[model samples]
Target: MTNADKKILKRLKKEDKKALTELYDSYWEILFLSSYNILKEREVCEEIIQDVFIDLWHNRAKLQIKISLKAYLYACTRYKVFAQIRKQKAIKVELFDDLKKRFQYTNPETKMMDKELVYQIEKTISTLPKKCRIVYKLSRNRQMSHKEIAEKLSISTKTVENHIGNALRVLKKSLGYTFSILFL
Candidate 1:
């Protein structure tokens, strides 16, 4: 850590507004640029940078940064940008999937069957191994895409797909012939 950053962090830990302002002034532009480079959204980048500082201020007393303040700020910006990307991807996927499902099963009986299928799938997911269950929940319940689940859980997309496959195999075995409807 630089001498200046160390001093600033020390004052920040003590709730010094001047230190917080200094930190913001020193890092905000760099952080914003870093995020903008990835997300390419002006307002989103601005909000992300603001969130980084807000988080820093809120957790100032417990800050345990092991890197330089600049690196830490950059890391935070990158993480926020990735999270925003994942959120956007998930929302888009969810919307598209919802539209498809809505059009596919409009009748009352099909709707009831849909509900039961979802319940059975969820029940089966609950019986999976910890990682597999989490992956399945994030993919099915949260409507996150495989890529989003992988990024959020810090795993490979292939790993996410594998986990989903494992969960599905379990579901198929447990639900028997009824599970075959999902493929159709």
Candidate 2:
């Protein structure tokens, strides 16, 4: 979180409407677009974003931002998306395996492409700065909040956020598309 983010958060904790509005304005489109891209359901994505904001405002008093606000909102939106997926009665292991088999057999070309893409992502991650790679891995693989990462590493949250931001920028440039879909 930047100093401005911290100030807004502090104001939000005090139940300031303007702070909430600022947060909502800054993040609404980002939340909507990311959720929509993954879920492919515009109405549900909009609802999810709205629900996230409502929850954020309602729980502002007790909020412990272990991540940047944007990251936190993204996590919340992701959880809601997965929750909706689960609610649709999709068995995780079976559904994933089924999807993989469907893709692998139906399109050998696509399967090869997928493999190459995964390899490229792995290679890119490996080339990141040591601390940036660590931060990225912790956030994506361990699902740790930035605050938790900072605390565990005895660093500031801003450093963790910076590392993540830098890593994402690098990955985005390397991938030539939306890297946030897989990580971030």
Candidate 3:
């Protein structure tokens, strides 16, 4: 945060309403757009951002931020968006029986297709350079965050991101038709 942001934060800690409004006015739109990119639902994204601001107000005095307010806000919004996705996935799983009745498909075919894709994906991964393969496996198999992979590999976060990006590009090229389906 800049000195001006620090001043606003200090005022917010003192429970100043103007500071709260200032923070909200400055951040709301960017935060809303970030959430919308993930959730793709305007109303839900709006509510999530509003909830974040309200939570900020409620815990203003106790807010401990190691990064800038922008980083903090973005991280919070991302987490909430991912949480919402998890909830939606759970609900979808619960509704699977109803959904299955509405569609006609054989599970064995789906399972076979999945297994074939997995085998092809593994083959593609095995062809990557050693560092890229390691980073990709740590990210996809272990479910580690980029920062965690950086820390584990004793590399910078940007390096980790680049490796992951390069790995994805290679996989997309190698898999061709299969790549788009994996992402979807």
lDDT for each of the candidates? 0.68, 0.71, 0.68
Backbone clashes in model 1, listed as residue pairs = none
Off by over 4 Å in 1: 90-184
- 97-174 per-residue lDDT for model 2 (tens digits): 443344333244434434555566678889998999999999977879999999999999999999999998887666
User: Could you tell me every candidate's TM-score relative to the true structure?
Assistant: 0.49, 0.51, 0.51
Give the distance in Å from residue 98's predicted Cα in candidate 2 to where it truly belongs. Answer: 13
Q: Is candidate 1 or candidate 3 better by TM-score?
A: 3
Predictions ranked by lDDT, top down?
2, 1, 3
TM-score of 3: 0.51
Q: List where candidate 3 sits over 4 angstroms from the true fold.
A: 90-141, 144-184
Candidate with the greatest lDDT versus the true structure: 2
User: What is the C-alpha lDDT profile of model 3 across 55-172, one tens digit per residue?
Assistant: 7787777665533565556545555765677677745544334322221122343334334455656888899899999999999888799999999999999999998888887666
Q: What order do candidates take by TM-score, descending?
A: 2, 3, 1
